[model samples]
Structure formats: C-alpha cells, structure tokens
Target: MEYTVVENSGYDREKDVFSHTSYWEAFSYRARHYTDSEIREMHVEIAIDLPDGTRTYEI
Candidate 1:
C-alpha cells in the first residue's frame, strides 16, 4: 500500500477541517478481529503515531 501527501487530502478531525477521504477509509469500519496480515493482503496500510509528536507511521 502506498500513501501520499496530496493537497486537500482526507479530513483532519483534530484540525476541524473537512477534506477528501483516503483509500484507508474503506477499512475504517471493519471489526477488531481483522488482522494486520489480512489488511495488508487487502492493500491497506496502517498508520501509527510514534513517540515523537511530529511523526506519523504509514505501513
């Protein structure tokens, strides 16, 4: 799965702005039983927040 920084990309709730939804949105509502391997097989990348406040992980 690939991620890009596009202008006007997906909504940022913390910023209170409405924007385009990314491909990941399709999987947002899935059950917790869904595994990372399953998601990867589905071409979805998981985003994680690192200890560094300025960093965001996309994998």
Candidate 2:
C-alpha cells in the first residue's frame, strides 16, 4: 500500500505562519497507510514535524 501523511503543517519563518498542508487526517479512514519507518522518513519528506512515537490504525 502507498503511504501518505494527511495532517500537514508548515512554518513560515519569514511570515511566521503555519497552516494545514493536507485536507485529510493522518490516521483518517480512506487515507493512505504508512509504516513506522516510513512515518519517520515522512517527517523529513513532508517537512512536517511529528511527535515522537507516532502511530496509525490498521483495521
């Protein structure tokens, strides 16, 4: 399955602004699923910071 991080945040130091980068929740239904390692890599891929030990539902 493909991996996607729905909940996205952006920080604009020049403007000091942050907002939702995606319209879907990180763990919402109908959204793409991601592995633990992928989640960690995603933090850098998406340039969004995720809290330590983030987890997603699989059912």
Candidate 3:
C-alpha cells in the first residue's frame, strides 16, 4: 500500500522531512480454506527520510 505523508511529524526529523514513502504489508487470511498451522505472514516496508532511518519491523 502507498501512504502519502499527511504532514511532517517533527518527532522523527529525518523521515519527517520527506513527504512520501513506499510501504508493503503482507498477511494471510482464510485459514479455514487453507492451512491453519501454516499461519499468515505480513511484510510492510516503507522508504522515507526520518531520524530513525525509515526502517521498522512489526510481527
């Protein structure tokens, strides 16, 4: 999914500067139709300027 910077959040100096970034989100759904044990994995990534350097991981 693409997310445009609504505004500059100064909390993150670097990332806040840039007004846009690329992001990816992945997930698994419909386990009943597929495999429950397989589980669903999601990958979300975005590119932008931020104090933290535009990198985050959430599982």
lDDT tens readout by residue for model 1, 1-59 = 32222222233432211112453542443324346675454433334334363324344
Q: lDDT (CA) for every model shown?
A: 0.34, 0.34, 0.28
Give candidate 2's error at residue 52 in angstroms: 27
Residue 19 local lDDT, model 1: 18
Q: Judging by lDDT against the true structure, name the best candidate.
A: 1
- What are the models' TM-scores? 0.23, 0.25, 0.15
Report the Cα lDDT for candidate 3: 0.28
Candidate 3: minimum summed lDDT over ten consecutive residues — where? 24-33
Q: After superposition on all CA atoms, how large is the RMSD of candidate 3?
A: 12.5
Per-residue accuracy of model 2 over 1-59 as CA lDDT, tens digit each: 23233322232322212223352442442224555665464431222333463433231
Best by TM-score: 2
